[model samples]
Target: MNIEANNTVNPEVKVGGQTLRWERQTIEKLLLANVREQRAARRWRMFKTLLWMALLAALVWALVAQPTLPKTPHSTGIGAGHTAMVSIKGVIADDGESSAEYILPALRSALEDSDSKALILLINSPGGSPVQAGLINDEIRRLRQKHDKPIYAVVEETCASAAYYIASAADQIYVDKASIVGSIGVLMDGFGFVDTLDKLGVERRLMTAGANKGFLDPFSPQTEEQRQFAQVMLDQIHQQFISVVKQGRGERLKETPEMFSGLFWTGEQSLQLGLADAYGSVDSVARDVVKAENLVDYSTEENIAERLAKRFGAAVGAGAVNALRSLPPLR
Candidate 1:
């Protein structure tokens, strides 16, 4: 009587004839309990695995996705078999690829790397920011002196304006014969809306803390004094560009009258002008110079969505933390 019942009727479930029996209800209850226990255990294990997987994913992202300044490497670790190259592409702005943030780290890495036989800079830009270009040029010279490694600049399709300015600092600048180069001049461009504003019956009531503070404002008319002052500034910057080109190119620069007149030149013309060392590409540098034959670009890949998400999340989290912290001390 394993069955729990008040009735006299037998609870035995006999299958075949010979009174073979077991308490049916009790067995069914036990089986259901065991099934529930197994299901619950399986669910717990699955949950644990999911938790561990999530933790591992977070750890991997932290280690691989984040961009940090590379530490300088020892000479022996870099040169004999390895070569590190950096690509300078896009607009050379303060925050972009040609910017200090993007370039300085790579330059520092190359300078410190002992095993890197050659530090190659792949140039493909129309050029921007003379100051940024000059800074990068100074760094290239410093790095070259410190590391004593040859730095090569390879112009892909175009290396005009500030791009050429930066490339001139390289030990050898190579370009494709059809590549665009030159445009070594400073320029200032702005629009004047004073006449348009008068037509639109609007007034620009601008006040300046200093007499020349708003000298170049587009809303104001250009005065002779302002024009002269602006020329002085442009000349100062242009002189800097000229000085760098002279310093970097030495006797290599074959500047005709048009070379610094803000006009670009074809790759062959650049070579003729001594603006470039040779008319070849990265393959030439690698195969002919460093003898690496193969190249690897270790630049950190940027993910816009991930960066935005992280920034937004961090801002929100920081706000919450600050709000909590700012509240009067919790009793």
Candidate 2:
């Protein structure tokens, strides 16, 4: 029995077939999952892009198309006979809310209104720029003469420095007994950083086109000549302030050594010194003094659009600064 049995296993066995099918199914599932993940990532990127685009659009709209609220009849000076009120409620600066740009228009509107019996300046501020206050004072006098309307100043909380400068223009000024009423003085304030910089080992390098251009620089020591020059300028302005107060108050002002010495006084003390007329309020003055019980505010109010535009501008400015800081430094 010369029978040679050759034992051979088939190449395409059932076990091998099963293993190949399993690997194929796993690869198909992995490919499907990868596609889904890519789609999700793309969608998220698109959403973020759209969100940024919307924010940019809104900022642009706020900047370009600053919409304002519709004026009511009272604001337009078209109402019944009333006491016209204009507010002076903050620092009197050229760029401030209490600036002449805003205040003058409201004053003119109030004075021009035929139905408005009288004009009242509702004042509550610690004062600021003398130049701005002077402008307002001049305008107040001119408008009072032109319109033949009685204008009164009703002080609240404070009526000092540049604020008193404006109040002086009024026919009469009323105040609360406890109100702070005067600081008839001018000042130029600053800080000296030369000593601090010396201690910190920092050098101040400044260039100016003119001699006095850098005279006010804090890092540089101020010359005696500069100091005297500044004092003279201040004195001249002080004289002007004194002259204005004298002219406004006339015989009503009782001259005292401390009166124009930059000393402030209480409303009661101011009354004694002729700085204020009497104790009264806006309502009382309107009802009793002007005899116009109705009140109409003719003040220029900051609108919502302006506020939003300002905030948006600030945000954009901050974002720009951050982006600049994050950039790679130049070689």
Candidate 3:
């Protein structure tokens, strides 16, 4: 007696007119096939799940650990606590890495950071353009007044001229005893090769509609009038720099009238001149005063790709400039 699982007829056997049918066995075979399919499906699902988990872990590690390309080796201060240090490098030019665009953002981050108790400006510039230096100084004032966070300027190997202008805005300026400081002045040095060109039978043929169109061309000799004019421009810039420093340092600056004559000073002489607030390195100030535990450098880390792009762009720009200069005079 055989009965199918779906419709059992409680009979010993179900037979057709010409053949007998094994219904129970057929039903068992169908059930076994379904069980095998389900088992294979479960194994496949487990394999897919394991693969997904491994891929996810690899992705997580890549995201959380943003790696940096190796750069010039230098020791940075590492404390036990969590405070960020914003470091400044190179000349403070309107263009290039030292521009206000790069500097002000770092300063703003440091000032607005809730985790940082105070901010440090690590300076190692020989100075650059007056405009760039002034822009930084203004931003520093605004940040200080807004955030009320103590800002310290730590001068490294050297901090002169425009660098000093920016540093003066710090709540207190710290310098290594051996650091080069001062140079509170402005200068635009250049060479005129017109006499040498005449000796070599070369001509500097220049024509301009404006009287002072080529005011300070390096290939042309300057008349006394032009020299006086250049000096006046330089003097004006120097005066502006002096005023900014005085405003930032207040009575802390004890400089003689000759300080703005474009002279450089050692870090030791700087303290007495009121150019710097103290003579100490970053570690001394951070550990002794701010009490920061860990120091994190917020400066942008340059990668190989970024540097290569910069070089390529610079080369293209230089080529364009040379091409334009080589063009014949417009008739």
Candidate 4:
């Protein structure tokens, strides 16, 4: 007997009960989706990395690179002869516009320039830090001797205290008739908040390892010993300042009783007292005294953007240091 075996085939014969065509298609779609997701993730990572790098580079450039300032067309108007000019205006504090840090470089450049006939410091300041003034004074003396170039100080509105201190180092100090000059002295000033704290019923708690760590704390009551020590220190600094003035001015100073008593005088009176050599303006000094009518400004001024950037960078660095520090603070 010839018998034919029954033939049967299930529709869902592939793995996971799917047809071969459907299984292959599903696998292809999954692979494509995975590839697309991987590509997008890679692109996002690359973008983020590049963005961070760009930000870091910008920050570095801002902090490290010197900010360029636009030179005015009239800045280089030293017509036939070269008369290098550096300005010392405002407070002469270590960090101020009239600080030695800014003035010294300009002075060096002016002195080093063979084309420069002379150097002039245009002064219009009420004075500030004696330390800064002393530094500039020393440098001016050295540069003058080295370069064999005469440096003159031409006072504008005022040149008192530290301003006068620096000007004393110049070969000659010229001033306007009404210019305020002198004030050869030193002072350490501060405010005491102990009474204010007592009125407010606020108690200050301070801890320190060193004995004199809270030496000049405003919240704490000062002892007689502390007061004496402070006075002694001030006296020493005052003597140092007096010595410098004497050394710089020599016999030119009239040696008045109030000269070193923090007393200021007019430019005309300064000439009589030998504090100033003559009465002249910048133009007059450059033309008549220096014999070079042309004036070339070498003064460096920081723009607002540069100042802000520097302050921001300094603040960021200080904040980082302060965050890591756990030392006792002075009140």
Candidate 5:
């Protein structure tokens, strides 16, 4: 007896002259692909969640570990004798660690405390913004007068330009024998890329609403009027610096041809010129001059976590502005 094949019950596929079951193979492949896709999606979600959690943890840690200002060294809270010390290191800018923002607060704290007999500014700087230095200088003088407490500036490596501007306001300026001392002048500086652009056959395209809006543009050809204007401004600022030095040093400054010619000198030469008073360190000034042996630092500094957070936050900004090649010159 011969039986007919059941086509409805079993589907078949012929491959290379060999019959194969089609339905089971198709179902198995589809199931495997779906499982793989699901697993990949789950893994991606887990990764995203972990990244967010890590960021949250870092934020929490930074907020919790806020930096604390250093305390003074008086045994009795409001006692008779202690020297207040504030560090003035690095470039002095409006937003920097060694600027009027931090220095004035430390000065005020030192002055307001009854136990603080005197304030000592320990300086090691190549100078920076004149405006910031002037603000700090003015505040120091005002505080000194108000509290009747002496404030001394002790130079370590360098005290030039704006740093000297600040130091000149102090009651006394002390320094190490090898320290670099003065730069009492102002200048507006820039590079001229007009020649370079001309050589490269590149034309500059700059537009401004105001006549002098792009005053110090390096790519543009410098005009005589602009040069004169800049010179006048620098001369005015230089005169102001000279006047300040004269006021601070009084008759002690020896008049010389190149004294205020934007020149620096050794600490010994500075003492000779009355730019500085004596050879001394922070320790010596605190011990011998202030008569308070204990030294406490009142320098404002960003902790590691805060710096990292700032870098992280500014990463996008940095990347966005990386292509901006043209920037204004500095004074």
Candidate 6:
């Protein structure tokens, strides 16, 4: 009897004068597949790492980048005589765009430019922090005296309260006929939630080391003494604001009983009241008054990077607060 070979059990098979190892071929294919998989995984990991690094770099740049100044024709050496402009827009707070920190630097740069015949303060704001306004006001006067460059305030839509406080420092104030002007006053505003809490039967638990530590806490009740004290402080600040305006306006101010009563008026009425010098815009003032047709903006505006960084900071702070709130309270 002839015996046939079992192809299934055979590790190697001979065909066409060549020996082929079936098990070796299977093993090789598996190894290749594993290698390819590992390579693909490594590539993905590298891509993720690079993406993370790029994001980190961008965040770092945003945090460290300086604010960009407005590009003007006078960026290089002063070529021709021009009127320098610094915009005081939005709320005039310590952390706002029209803050003294930002405004003062722009003012100095504009005044220091030899080609600039005059500086114009383009103001449009409802008003904000008194302290910030006061600082800007003081610097404007000082810069004018030092540089011997006349500074004029050109009001647009509105210039009231703290906005007017800084504008008062200018040599002359020009306003549009329909512009809102004045509001020479001080105010401290807040809401009282004590009554609401009582109606809701919600108790407020507050602890403070000092008696006046929680003076203006909205959740708590305010004492008569505290109210009186706050009023006194506001009165003092109001007086200071009034004095500054008087000094800045000098003989031009036509003070009335309601002028400093936190009242606003039209720009036309402002001129009649001597709160403004004349009717003019930035262009008209630069062309006719300053005698320099060429205009150069020296405003120190917040750049994209600075704004991004600020927003990022706020987001991180809010996230942290939320995380803290979500945590379990300690015994």
Better of 1 and 3 by lDDT: 1
**Which candidate would rank higher by lDDT, 3 or 5?**
5
lDDT of 5 by residue, 1-331 (tens): 3323337677665555566777888899999999999999999999999997887687778667665343433333645767878889999898678878778777777777777788899999999998998899889889989989998999999999999999999889999889999988787777889989999999899999999888799998878998899999889888988988999889889968899999999999999998999999988999999898877566667665666677777986787677464465556
* Predictions in order: lDDT: 0.80, 0.87, 0.77, 0.83, 0.84, 0.89
Worst 10 residues of 1 by lDDT: 12-21
Across residues 218-252, which tens digit of lDDT does each residue of candidate 2 receive?
89999999999999999999999999898898999
**Tens digits of lDDT, candidate 3, 1-331:** 4433334463334343323346666889999999999999999999999996876565556444543322222223342254557777887776556678777777776656566677788999999988888898899889889978788899999899889988888889998778898888878888788889989999889987887778688887677888899899989998898898888788987879777778878888888888888877778788887887566666544444444556667988999999999999999
TM-score of each: 0.72, 0.77, 0.70, 0.73, 0.79, 0.79
Give the higher-TM-score candidate: 2 or 4: 2
Instruction: Summarize candidate 6's per-residue lDDT along 1-331 as a digit string, tens digits.
Output: 3333346775555665567877889999999999999999999999999996886687678646654553333343656588999999999988777988788888888887778899999999999999999999999989889979999999999999999999999999999999999999999999999999999999999999999999899998999999999999999999999999999999999889999999999999999999999999999999999999888888887766677668878999999999999999998
- Evaluated against the true structure, the overall lDDT of model 6 is 0.89
Q: Give model 2 RMSD, 1 decimal.
A: 8.1
lDDT of 1: 0.80
| Candidate 3 clashes between residue pairs 3 or more apart in a chain or in different chains | 1-12, 79-293, 80-293, 81-293, 81-294
Report clash pairs, candidate 6: none
Best of the two (1, 6) by lDDT: 6
Candidate 1 residue pairs that clash: 75-114, 78-115, 78-116, 79-115, 79-116
lDDT score of residue 121 within candidate 4: 94
Most lDDT-accurate candidate: 6
Better of 4 and 6 by TM-score: 6
Lowest summed lDDT window (length 10), candidate 5: 67-76
Model 4 residue 85 lDDT score:
91
- TM-score of candidate 1 against the unseen true structure: 0.72
